[model samples]
Target chain A: MKPILECKGLGKSFGQKKAINNINLELERGKIIGLLGPNGSGKTTLLKLANNLLTPTAGEIRIAGFNPGPDTKQIVSYLPEKTYLNEWMRVKEIVEFFADFYRDFDPDKALTMLSQLGVDAKDRLKTLSKGTKEKVQLCLVMTREAKLYLLDEPIGGVDPAARDYILETIISNYHEDATVVISTHLIADIEQVLDYVIFLKDGQIALTSAVDKIREQEGKSVDSLFREVFKC
Target chain B: MGWDFETDRPIYIQIMEKIQLLILAGVYPVGAKLPSVRDLAQQAAVNPNTMQRALAQLEEEGLVITQRTSGRFVTENEEKIIQARRRLARDQVTQLLVKMRELGLGKEQILEIINEIAEEMKI
Candidate 1:
């Protein structure tokens, strides 16, 4: 089977500053991958490039044998770092909106997750706390049966309890054929859930290896390795 | 129900050890159906693939059996379970002996220490 996401010599620059450079990656389906890096390391940029939110200045990125476009968008579910929902809209409204917009969206699943999170669907987005909003966004994103999930800092805002639920939700929602790519600095919290990890350093691919391989060979956690690699 | 893992070891190996310990303790009794891989993964907060690998290792060791249509189950053979218990006990003893040797204790001294501790425990 073709890799779910593939990139070769992929580079993206914002005029003078290059966000990511000469990146080559081939991610398979049915795995959870962590994209680890410090601030300004281009983790978000890489995700955005794959999601077709940004055009690569050099090289090419393909999702399941096709370039990033409408077809790829249909298969890729993305949760950006910032909250993009309209504050005036109610939780159920947004859920309905997503259901209407994305063919793969499951409103029932979204509603169930929201209730499980103690979030009321009748409440407007503006009334909820930041953490709650993040939860809602995650619920929406995860309810989609996309082939690839690109989540940026999915657990950064929530408390430990919510973080566990989010992780469980992620694992339970995807099928054996879907791939989840999570970009975050909280490597320790999500390390166990990841099958593989790709370390991004200064706009370049630093390292990519199976999580178990890192523990077995390096005799250290992925979090420890990340700290050592990106230490100030 | 929490699964604790050491950072230095491979997660799948840790998971495999955990399941073996559970089986030995009768937590997952012989011939009992095991939970689905996804459920186990969620409970352990690890990847499903990792859990699958661990369960596969268990199957290879004859500690688990997977049916075609039905789910996985613990081995029904009591003899196999007994052998597994012995093997685990041997591994533990080997590790303990290695630690004793590292502490500069001779075989006689280690035996004496073990006898003293066993007497104290009345076993």
Candidate 2:
């Protein structure tokens, strides 16, 4: 399979402290990969570098064979660890913004999902419950027909009920041809859907394998292996 | 009908296999429709998404088929059930062997326990 994303000797530093170091990796299309790690393991930082929200202090990254330029941005949808949508915007307005920006935006899908989740499009972002807003963000991200999805902690702070809903939308709505790379600490909740697993530690990759291979060879769930590999 | 809370194995995959076992047992007869993904998920206390994934996997394996609006149904082919059962058995045996190894048990001990369980299960 051709890698849709590749990073070689990737490194990033915040002044004197390093967030990631000398990493090498590749992600193929049509796979759901979990980027698993503890906090400060450089999971978010590497995702940022992939999205080009930050540049690598060393090494290289290529999304769809192109550096993260406007062209690459068109193909990548990102859900940040923190809310990136303006709090002043209404829910419908946020939908409109994403619809306007991405050619593959599915407005009807977004509208249908919003109704299903019982989120009111008329409510201002400021008025909706924080958890609801996160769901809305995830829904909009799903509306995109992008090739690569960079979801940072998509279910990090949500209740288990909401987490299941969010994860379902992700699996059901992603285009069959698309690739989803979700970075989060919620392993057991997501261990079911993941086709691949990447264990990141200290900003470098510790393990990356097809989920099936990992399960077949290791004789343990990804959660168990993750605990053993990155003991807290 | 429901998910087992034991084992670190994912609940979705378990539900997926459980649905197949149900079909094999004639609980969901050939061509008989199954429960809604949401309802089954609720029954398992699993996220509906996990249930959907399990159902989707079944669809992919040809043991089940989905009709838009009508709902998912067990395939009429008994071969599909046989195949699904074989796959599930292989995985179960593999996991069992691994657990035995972890407990430092030899093949003789493992087979003895298997025989005891088989008598209990009457399978």
Candidate 3:
């Protein structure tokens, strides 16, 4: 089967600084993959390139065999690091907006998760706490029946309880055949749910392998290994 | 019940060990239906594919059986359960002996330590 996502000699740059370079990756289906790195490691750049928010200065990327465009966008559900919902809109209205915008969006699943997370649909976005707003955004993204989920820092700023809820929602929401790529600096929290991990460093691919393989061979968790590999 | 894992080893191995211990300890009684793979994965906070891999290993060992329409269940064979328990106990003893030997204790000293611990436990 064709890989869910592939990058060949992928490079991105801004002015004089290179953000990503020579990235060759092929992500398979049914895996929860972690795109891990510290700040300024191009994790977000790579994700944006994959999501078509930015064009690569060199090389190419493919999602489910299509280049990042209208075709791939339909199959890719993305959650940026920040909340994008308008503060004046009620949570229910945002759900309706998403349902209308994305053909794959499941309003029922979004509503169920929102209610379970104690998010009142009648409440405006500005009324919810910061973490609650993030939760609502995540709910909207996860409810889509997309083939690839690009979750950038899905659990970064939330409380531990909310983090767990987000991780569980991620695990249960996506189809088994679909791939979910989660980018975050927090490795220990999400390590168990990941099947594979990609470590980025200084605009290059540092390491990529199955999570169990790393554990068996290195005799350390990914977090420990990350510290060792990227110790500065 | 909570599942604690050592980070340096394969998760599927830990998951299999946990399920085996649960079976031998009667937490999942013989012939009892096991939870679905997804439910077990959620409970253990592990990936579903990893949980499935562990279940497949159990099936290979004949400690668990699956029905085409229904789900997995602990083996009904009492003798198999006893054998599994005995195998696990033997492995545990072997590991203990190896550790004791590494500490420079001969077989006689190991036996004495066991006796001392047993006596202390009886009180």
lDDT for every model?
0.94, 0.82, 0.91
How much does candidate 2 score in TM-score? 0.74
Per-candidate TM-score against the hidden true structure: 0.95, 0.74, 0.93
Candidate 1 residue A57 Cα shift, in angstroms, is 0.7
Winner on lDDT between 1 and 3 is 1
CAPRI class of candidate 1: medium
Clashing pairs in 1: none
Predicted candidate 1 versus true structure: per-residue lDDT over A100-188, tens digit per residue: 88999999999999999999999999999999999999999999999999999999999999998898888788889999999999988
Structure candidate 2, residue pairs in collision: none
Between prediction 2 and prediction 3, the one with superior TM-score is: 3
Candidate 2 segments whose C-alpha is farther than 4 A from its true place: B1-16, B27-123
Which one wins by TM-score: 1 or 2?
1
**Cα lDDT, model 1, residue A58:** 98
The alpha-carbon deviation from the true structure for residue B89 of candidate 2, after best TM-score superposition, in angstroms, is 11
In terms of docking quality, model 2 is incorrect
RMSD for all candidates, in order, please: 1.7, 6.8, 2.1
* Model 3 agreement with the true structure over A1-232: per-residue lDDT tens digits: 7899999999999998999988999999988999999899999999999989899999999998889998898899999877778999999999999998899999998999999988999999999888889889999999999999999998987888878888887777768999999999899888888899999998899999888888889988898999999999
